[model samples]
Target: MAFEELGRFGVWRPFGGFGSEDARELEALGYGTLWLGSSPPGDLVAAEELLAATETITVASSIVNIWSEPAAKVAESFHRIEARFPGRFLLGIGAGHPEIAAAYKKPYDALVEYLDALDEAGVPAEARALAALGPRVLKLAERRSAGALPYLVPAAHTASAREILGDKALLATEHKVVLDADPARARATARPRVDFYLGLQNYTANLRKFGFTDEDLTKPGSDHFYDELVAHGDATAVVDHLAGHLRAGADHVALQVLDDDGQATLRALAPLLREVA
Candidate 1:
């Protein structure tokens, strides 16, 4: 199935912590998809377990790093998952940050080569999506693959991406949501998480394009930057903030709830799920 058909919202979780029971619960809660983050090489085994435990819901890797995992291995895993789950698996691939890679080469070139390898290995383009943030990578995703799955982006970026991708390509944007209503504490809790990505050039560049100044992109993002990027406050407020993405041309939104515990995060988000759906 095409990425656009995956519906309005999905759950984004780190692959390590969630078990089959958690997967089943999310499926029962009416999430159309489950996106696993920072998965290891050949880690689709865990994805298979989640897929096996749930029915109807689609499973995707928020990213399977291009550096560590070979295209052939990924292709094999894709085939295996597709054989069993069929239309329920969506492959989200990316050239992870240069700092993390052993070789530390040009990411765009590496991503193109990786996609070429996947193509040569007989992995159909429609079965995959890209984790792209910049204009060049977003265009590449439209041309070489199914669509783009951009993380931690605002609605303006989604609107810009839609213009670049035109009408047909899928545009799924990931948003981080915090359930806290207290402004100061919410921003405090979100600061560390936001700080990590603030130094990344892609994220910084995207923020610039979205009208944020260099000062706004500093160590801890400015209040203006944090509020735009991270959706915080009550369930209703969170839903209203997310709706901006849909209004801005996002085909789907993957939500990552920020909380000390994953179970508590899901529980807090339970009420907002139906609004997103």
Candidate 2:
């Protein structure tokens, strides 16, 4: 239940954003983990590269979509990574969206089956986590895996999830950050990202549970909705917003900086990482 390995602050980026140099840089900057987003392949070559590039930072899949990646294959990838990198790898699995996956159906049940396969394949429960959102899946994550990696949520949801996960389970929340002082400019960069997810039912349903109105979820999203999901402002303010998740009972916060190449933001936040850590 203790995910002390991942530490407090982690970086979340797509495959293109994270490379050998980037991994080394983030590691040097004191980031405890690097999450490979966008449903990384079952083979996990990208994870291996990052693991080999850095000496200590944990590398995790934001999620290997259960609908796309066979549980057995992912379990195999887990073993391969663990064998080479040891405790530096964490497998993050999820059902993804119904619209995107042709095989998506009874997602909760599919997740249960996938976990069973992983268990059969000898992947330790502590070695993986789930991209959980709802109460049911959150409970599943607590019972079956290391913890929950809920995405695009506010600190309030972290508090709610911690109540469900209790004191033992690892609760890592993924929060977007825009390191821009201008509110308009920040929201301009964040709106498209929010809009894309608004088209996905799972994300919208989760947002609604936290009191987001139908109006708030409409295309382009409301200003309040964007502000709640994405922390914007200077480095100090962004770090403070991310810390809300930790204060809300989250053990870790994976920050996804919105902009071209998150290097500048990461560099700017290097000194401030300890505040959130």
Candidate 3:
């Protein structure tokens, strides 16, 4: 009924750039987990460093790309991290975008093979989650991994993913928060990122199902769409956005504070985010 390991909320930050000290600060701030969303090297060596730095905060990959990092190698890394950190490490994997991978096949099938390899290589199912955005993959996540980790989605999508994942699997949603109250400035900061995502078919397809129109899905995205997706404002506004996920049946919400990142921002926002608990 709960992802006690991941806790109720966590911070989603770049895995490679920040170090153990940054992780320690987030732990001190009361964030339950440190989700590594930015792509790190295939070895997951950075994750181990973060684990060594903190006693209680969990460290998870919002995703490690299955395309770039082979399952066998990732599986080996998984085993090593698990051996050192045990339950504190969670391996998150994704099929990635066709534009990103030259050999992007039927992603669902590719993901199936990846999971199979992980199974054979001693990567436990409970220690992993899939960055799934659709029904087919969401079902696979429920059956094979811990659960679904949907990104760049709204509370509506979280509700849908929960239905697809049912009660057993964890529904950990990745939500972005910009620490600015100005609507125009916030959307401006978020638009370029949204434009890049618009090029990805997987993200666009999922957002469409969530009721975003073609015009809304256009480059830079409509202001309404951007505003709905990014929780742009002060810490209080961001907490309200994170709560929407919990209310929509999300077991955990990965707090991805956009643009203004690093240890200082986490420290500044910690008190505000912890109040939500």
Candidate 4:
């Protein structure tokens, strides 16, 4: 089955953290999708409520940890949400970081098993997506699911992923945007939030493949690293940065704003919503 066509750029934030009223407002603002970040087990049902409250906007789990939720449970949730919301729900599942899943042995293998179980439970391929960074996992996503949903990556990776998945599968990427124009402050605001991921081998290796040097991958991210990973400055500047992902072959881009205040961040991004739609 074909999922709803998401716009080039959508808003990325935590679902439970945002009020239903705020979600309605975002839907009314012409945003094509809402991507929820790192949710706990059984949160997909709550995600469905957010989608049900809005009209025409797709709501996706930026990633639901495969180790945290069993495929059977995920399938049940998917069925319920799909029956209720239909094409508006996209299951974005991933093998979470090794550190977090240290107790769960063989994560990659476990992810394969999870996907198998999801299939056994009758979740359709087009209704699901994988949070893949490497070529191996990207190929797996292509064969087994809808496509790859890569996070904290550059446009070059999107181009490569498109090649790996071919033209039919989705190539949705997550991008961080800072409304601040000041380079230092913007990087500072984005650093700690993304620092942990930079330390992860999956993210670092992806950055390295995209031509970021070992020096560029250092802690808090080098200037070059920050510049490429986090888009900063005015609304137009942020829009320009996101456009590169489309140019590089991404099917969809989810924009996560890093700002001091949530309300202000939404307000600052209002003008750019027109460009996104």
State which candidate has the highest lDDT.
2
lDDT of 4: 0.82
Overall lDDT per candidate, in order of appearance: 0.83, 0.90, 0.83, 0.82
Off by over 4 Å in 1: none
lDDT by residue (112-171, candidate 1, tens digit) is 999998899888888899998888999999998889999878899999999998888888
What lDDT is reached at residue 87 by model 2? 89
lDDT of 2 by residue, 45-124 (tens): 99999998889899999989998889888888889999998989989999999889998889999999999999999999
Candidate 3 lDDT over residue span 33-76, tens digit each: 88887666669988888888789888888789888898999988
RMSD values, in order shown: 1.6, 1.1, 1.7, 1.7
TM-score of each: 0.94, 0.98, 0.94, 0.93
lDDT of 4 by residue, 1-277 (tens): 3533576667788666657887888777666678888754554766887877888888888788887777888899889988888888889899878666765677678879988998899999888899999988999999999988999998889889999989888999999988888989889989988777867887887788889998888886788888898889877887888878988888788888777675566666767757654
Q: How far out, in Å, is residue 140 in model 1?
A: 1.3
TM-score attained by model 4 = 0.93
